[model samples]
Target: MRLRAMVHRHHVLGPGRVPALGFLALLATVLLAGCTSQGGAENSLARPLMQGSTAPRAMSPVERLANDLAMADVAFENGDAKALANHLQSVDLAGATPSDANGEAKLNAWRSSIAAAPPAMRGRVLGPAYLSGILAAGSRINTEQVLLGGKAVSIAAGTAPRDTLRLRIVRGDGKIVCEKSPAHARECRFVPTYTQRFRIELYNTGPEDARYHLVFD
Candidate 1:
């Protein structure tokens, strides 16, 4: 997907907190693997846009988790309130609190911000995780655990020649959230870009090449 389109979607979607949480939930399932270097330790889609640097750093597991989690944080701040609330319904508030009062305050603020999200976005918040979870449950798919930076990143295996599978994320009522696209986070199993349409790419990450297509949609 074009970066501009992603920016537009970011705006239209309201509080991105839910999507960010969805991203985190996915990560939780795969947090065993350390980080991988896409560009560098601090590389994120936002960094270059801010500093105008193209240099890539090898991301440590810690850095990748921080970046992904931070991306969700930014999204939550900008997203609608109602969706944020619904999303928070599933979160463990006790777990969110930090030992320090300052940390607790920050967590509380995050919770409040989500509660302030608009009603329209409430149902859409869980779409990404719901869709992905459903896919994981329905298939006898392989899940890989890798460390990126230091955080565990889990990726569901794509058989034979493919290493990735793209999924269209949608609300239970069938609203398009995002499409699977090339711009998705490297560790993401489903890219949220092609909402109404989906394309699954299975890579032969293994040495020997294999081929298969359209056995199932």
Candidate 2:
């Protein structure tokens, strides 16, 4: 029934009515989420929308961090070397600077362990479908950061509210390569063209202001 409804909507929102690009991107995301297996980390994150948008779904600290670490591991195994490389690049930890080699080694070890694991466990080790779905959805929503200078930048979007979003860039041997910002309050369209590993740090510039949630994808 749900499939039928989605198909009908797809047909109704034909090329003439729906723009080919963004709508197709969203549709692809939805399909990917639907097709992925459900359970554990992936299901926990991915099914939030499948279950319903109104209800809140969150992972426990242990679960969330574990998921993140697992993702970082899988990213490395799946030839997503660029993903970690991007994260490292974003951190600007090039050999030019002092750094944490231990952390870099740990990341490498994590990847190595996953790579050595049996093929059957690889997907779960990486993260379930839901995790990928959420990330994919977020990626489609446009995002932009205006470098404020010196490791600081002002993030603006079509609907990003007034707030200072925190950013975190991971590094490998002192270099950044990829980045991701946690979900925020506000809907916007800004695609990040740069490939690097970084995360967002959101803050309310307004004193005593109400909390806001940013939604993309």
Candidate 3:
């Protein structure tokens, strides 16, 4: 949603009418759970809801990362420090390489930002509908899924920035549903008229192995 939070019936609530800050202190649970190994890596305050987009769907880890970042973008534009703090907890700063090439200093800056935010906005949540695998050079992987009728379907995929990955979605009869040329990131969206299976094809045209992650909602 919009990363907007409102006090509802005496509680701070975010998308899907879920409690955003049950109490500012509860956010610590999210930080410890998502950033650490508490209750496993997937524990959180809530998984960002895509309920209307699919029947009881959960965002995959990759999808949740994308959604949280997307929400963080909105928070940044609107100067919603609380939302920014909440959404960013999902980022694995401990293991991430900074695109800025500033190394640990850059990551520490991010940690400082998160640490400085008020206790209320320091948590992250994501759904689960993702696929990931390694593709050898010049190899392809085919996957299929059943998308029910009357729901908006969205899919996002990406590979290492240096890889050339082409993605295509096709129907049983060979009709192309969506296609993306060689690139680092791709997305597809549609609303099917009826329940049906669609095939997803990922081709690695690069000269080395490529790992890909695809998420849907």
Deviation from native of the Cα of residue 107 in model 3, angstroms: 19
Candidate 2 per-residue lDDT over residues 1-217, each given as its tens digit = 9999999988887765657788899999988776774445676887787867565666432223323433444455566765644432322221111124544464445445433432222222222111111121112322232322234222211112223332233232334333333333222223333433334333333333322222111
Q: Model 1: what TM-score? A: 0.20
Candidate 3 lDDT, tens digit per residue, 1-217?
3333334523533353544556555888777777677554344423434333566556544445544544544455466767777765654421212232333343354446554743322243334344545679999988888888889787666565334788788976789988876634446777888899999888888888765555565
What do the candidate models score in CA lDDT, each in turn?
Answer: 0.36, 0.36, 0.59
Work out the TM-score per prediction. Answer: 0.20, 0.19, 0.45
The TM-score between candidate 3 and the true structure equals 0.45
Using lDDT as the measure, the top candidate is 3
Cα lDDT for residue 195, candidate 2: 38
Model 1 regions lying over 4 Å from their true place? 1-72, 114-217
How well does model 1 score by local distance difference test?
0.36
What lDDT score is found at residue 206 in candidate 1?
A: 36
Flag clash pairs in model 3: 58-127, 58-128, 59-127, 59-128, 60-127, 60-128, 60-129
Which 10 consecutive residues of model 3 have the lowest summed lDDT?
A: 93-102
